[model samples]
Target: MQTALLFPGQGSQYIGMGQDLFTRSIVARRTFEEASEILGYSVSNLCFQGSEADLTRTDYAQPCILTVGIAAFRVLVERMEREPVYLAGHSLGEITALTASGALHFADAVRLVRFRGMLMRDAQKHKAGSMMAVHGLTPQVIEKECLEPEYRGLVVISNLNSSRQTVVSGQVNALTKIKERFTDLGGHVTPLQVDGAFHSPFMKNAAMQLYDELRLIPFHSMRYSVLSNVTALPYPNVNCIPSFLSEQMVERVRWQGCVQFLMERQVYNLIEVGPGSVLSNMLRREKLDACMIQSMDKKEYLQKLIKESLPKGNRAVSYAHYLKAALCAKNYNIHGETSNYLKEVAGPFRELEQLARSGDVADGNAKALEALNHILDCKMTPAIQRGGILSHIAEEGVVRHV
Candidate 1:
């Protein structure tokens, strides 16, 4: 079966969620433990025993959900001997897929996620923005209604979850206005339990922070053809991924595009590797093929999809994957003397940083890193390995090695 792994983002999290798997499977427990070591906090405690309020914090939620997704992914890898033909995720979930596809280390992925949440959270400035799901109609109708002219720039379809279902986000006035439009447009609207508007320009500042994070953090080439939320296709060029990820924050998430692309590519089996059924539900609705949609919330998906997602060679390892333990045998750095684009990345990032000043510290860190990397112009591995002046850049967020 040509399989694809789908990861769910923030809204999928729930209290006392991943405990069952952590308790029952050694693979699951090891993954969680390793994540705790990387993050410098008790991630497992938050996922297993923490209250909703504690786990729901932006910083915590990013890493927490990723750890669970990774934990489940590890178990799947242990059981399955081969990787899938495709991979994707919704919102923050896309980062999870990027990590799984060798574009990032699990530790760095979690850190970036923590910052992703914090920065995005601060960008809001507490205007009481929120999201709601509208179903039972075509995206065309929903868009026309939710995006009526009077509510211009107010209510926008944030998460295009599927062809028939999308989540709208924005101000209260805009949302109420959009809901009326949805009602008139023959679409059903259900207010989501979320607290902020995401995926719209209102979250533009958060997207700016995410752009910064994209710069500072490194991205690697995909082991397989993974869909980009920015373009809804295999990343056009690995070198241009920073912009793609940065824009994904404020740009419309082309989830329907991802599903359609995978389906057209003949991927019959799609796995949702996370803590909920949300992504899977969307896939079933969007793709009518005998689409074997599975989720990490259940044991079956963990066992089945991991087998489907990993390649013949890159399976579970005999060692723990802590950042310190996982460095390359040779110390290599790009030294920033090679490319001009590395320098060009600065302009956009500086713009993002200006927008992020009132936001979280993590937001600043993310943007600054993006600018630094753009100046270096290579994948993170070489961009950060350079010494002297460039070594200064690597220390932005890295936990130093002794």
Candidate 2:
């Protein structure tokens, strides 16, 4: 099974995200306890009991998410049949991926992200700004809107999450203007739940300080191909990671391109090993086959699914099942009662229904997994073949034609 591991950024955090793994897995408990000592505080408490406001702070959120993300990965790693072929992360999650790939030590990573968050908080304090998610708009239209006379030089596209979802970040006034204009243009605009205007020029000060901190940490050669948010491609060398990671603070997160890169290389099954399903939702919205396993239970389900699907030395074909189901749903709008057969067959991917209904807004974690299971031992239908969505996917990347 060719797999790419994804770690989510700041907004993916929740109060009791890693508590399940910590309670059930000794490896996860050790990872969290080690992180607590490295940061000189109770990271476990911040994740298990902290309120929304506390978890939203840049300093607390970055480390807490990183710790939980890495901890969850540790618990799941022991059961994996193979290591991931690639690793990618969004915003601060990139640091976690780096640590997982052996590019950065866990202790150094926790401390560096903490310091980086503090510096970013300082930058945010000096220059007040905000971010807004503008959906149903192309990147060109959004960029054009940001450069309009009234908002020129103040606002920029901070995150290219998907073809239809772009996030804008800048001064409060500029954000307000863009939000109003985009909404009037028949687009959906929602303010992001963040403490600062991340991935924009507003973070230059933080970027500068973060570079210095990055230099102090020793970086080793990566064990897997790691994609960068700033470049939207794999790093040519391990040496470029530190500077590029620092620069990521003030650059656009080219997430859409990063996912496309993985698909182009045939890395179909992108697994999000963290708390929330944000990245998975974006992948589904783009019609890319993806799944998430955040807790110990989900990890066990994944292992069982893989075992059940690829018994007796069969080459792993679970990813093909997932891709077929996603294509079938997209092309046929196969849902409700018509998809009941799918629900019964999709032992692992039963959650695909919710994902198909909500797109990127779907909050369920098991949908993609269940969809994968449905097609594991099943054959493709004639309708899916005639639609040619899967053929189009092969030639032009993962997004569905319809």
Q: For model 1, how does the per-residue alpha-carbon lDDT over 1-402 read when each residue is reduced to its tens digit?
A: 777888888878887767866766555666687778887888888887788877666678888888888776655543443457777878788888887765776767877888877776776666767788888777776677655677767777777767678787888877887787677767788986455677778777777767777788756555556688878888665566677777877788888888888888888777777787878776666657677777768766544543342233322221111112222213222333334434534474455445445443331233333333333322333211323222232234331110
How high is the lDDT of residue 78 in model 2? Answer: 38
Error of 2 at 313 (Å): 25
Clashing residue pairs in candidate 2 (N, C-alpha, C atoms within 3 angstroms): 346-374, 348-369, 348-370, 349-369, 349-370, 349-371, 350-370, 351-367
Each prediction's TM-score versus the true structure: 0.72, 0.73
The lDDT of model 2 is 0.71
Model 2: per-residue Cα lDDT over 1-402, one tens digit each: 477889999888888887876765445676788889998889989898999999989888999888888876654453455657889999888899887776676788889888988987788786788788888989898888888888887899999998879998898877887788998888999887788888998888788888887777766556567899988988887779778988898899999999889878888767787777888777777765444323222556544632432213213223443444454543222322445445545554445444444444211223343343224213222222423433332233232111
Candidate achieving the largest TM-score: 2
Which predicted model would earn the best lDDT? 2
Relative to the true structure, candidate 2 reaches a TM of 0.73
TM-score of 1: 0.72
Cα RMSD of predicted structure 2: 16.9
Name the weakest run of 10 consecutive residues (lDDT summed) in model 2: 393-402
- CA RMSD for every model? 12.7, 16.9
Q: After superposition, how far is residue 370 of candidate 2 from its true place, in Å?
A: 33
lDDT of each: 0.65, 0.71
